[model samples]
Target: MGLIAEHNCSMLLMDHVPKLLVSSIPDSQVVKNINCGRTKTAQIIKMLKIEAENELVQQLTKRKREREREREREREREREREREREKRERERETTKEEPEPAVTKKKNYEVDLAILKIIDEDSAGVSGLDMPEIFIDFNNSSSNKLLLLDEITEFSVLVVSVENDLEENILTETKVSST
Candidate 1:
């Protein structure tokens, strides 16, 4: 009789405890009086399983969003790094494009010396004695004058004409005068 009583108590606990735990009902009598079938139990289990799956899906979505944000941050860092590298490359190229200071200084020195030499020669010419004048006419042609300075006191002059008619006229005049 004691064993049968214990068995009945265990059956009562098994039937009522799960409903009480799952529904959080304060009244044990309501749980015992409720007629819960296999379909109802299965539906409750399915609802709990669906809730668990929803929570898992929400966690996975949060993790996926976090990963996407991290990827964007990494891409931004890479873009910044590339910009800095390009800036450095541009600076290097600009430095390479400029002339070196030493070479520029040498060129300026050579130009200054040439200017000074021309000034000195002009001053010497001004201080020299009187020079002779020679005339050659080229009304319809081109001509060039060259001065040969052999010494400080002696010089020679040469004139070149570019037209055949002028040369013939000069030669004929010279020949008539000489004959």
Candidate 2:
């Protein structure tokens, strides 16, 4: 019998080898099949097993990479949330601080008296001829004796009235301290 050198060989595991010498080529006539020569069939089987293992390893690696990426994204989102919460807390704390009020006051005093009596009451032992400008300081807390140099001014006016007018224009000049 002549061996067909161009034929492909493969192995088929069996419980029993055929006792009779059948045709050398398989019924399928494929390059690799279950009924090929022993040596070539063993090599094909090894190659198939290695390929299956390689495919499984590649699938597992892909799944791991996807899971790691998702975990990284989750960590980044958590950090951002923490930062936002801190910013909000800082803003609320700043808003809770009380604002300062302006520190100033104003008072108005009205005086209608003779200028010489005011000078006599305010200035003592200072002759009227030597008086230029006199200022008075009072130590008493009496309301009747309380005196203020500000809120005082002199104005001269002539009366003029319109028919059925119930309003009067009164003008006074005063030195007032204000903020």
Candidate 3:
């Protein structure tokens, strides 16, 4: 108030207030300390933001890798199962050569059940800021806890989208066009 009254210039009040205060303060050390503190605060906030982003990226990559590894392990199990079945059939054929011929039958492949990944989104508004809610595979049941979201963090989704297979010759063969 004193600085503003003395200066008699209230134009761009916010921009002038800091300068006026700095000018009024006799000690340069005080001004330097204030500027240094502001700079440090800004740097800390920036570093925190960067760290948060890096952590998110790392988590996403880890989830993707785990899913890939699990899929690969499942595929390998199926392959091993098929190989064992083939080996048993070969052994049976060799031993039953002297026996009477049996009726031909189709062999059934082993079927495995897959678990569906679900994300609990209590909020209707999933989109926050410019970035969309990141899709994550949460195996644990989150029924007991409430969905928490911050300004930097949004809700999780399953990332389901509509897709159609378009053949290469379809455009030329069908001649799809809007009138």
Q: For this target, which candidate reaches the highest TM-score against the unseen true structure?
A: 1
lDDT of 1: 0.42
**Ranking under lDDT, best-scoring first?**
2, 1, 3
Model 2 lDDT tens row, 1-179: 21122333311422122212123223443332345556655654455456546656887999999999999999999999999999999998888775658643323332222121133233346555333222222213234353444433333221222222255433333222222
Q: Poorest 10 consecutive residues of model 1 by lDDT?
A: 105-114
Clashing pairs in 2: 10-36
* Clashing residue pairs found in predicted model 1: none
Query: Which candidate number maximizes lDDT?
Result: 2
TM-score of model 1 relative to the true fold? Answer: 0.40
| TM-scores of all predicted structures | 0.40, 0.38, 0.31
CA lDDT, candidate 1, residue 118:
14
Which residue pairs clash in candidate 3? none
Q: Name model 3 segments beyond 4 Å from true.
A: 1-42, 99-179
lDDT of 3 by residue, 43-133 (tens): 5335434654665688799999999999999999999999999999999999978677874432221211211222323322456522222
What is the total number of backbone clashes in candidate 1? 0
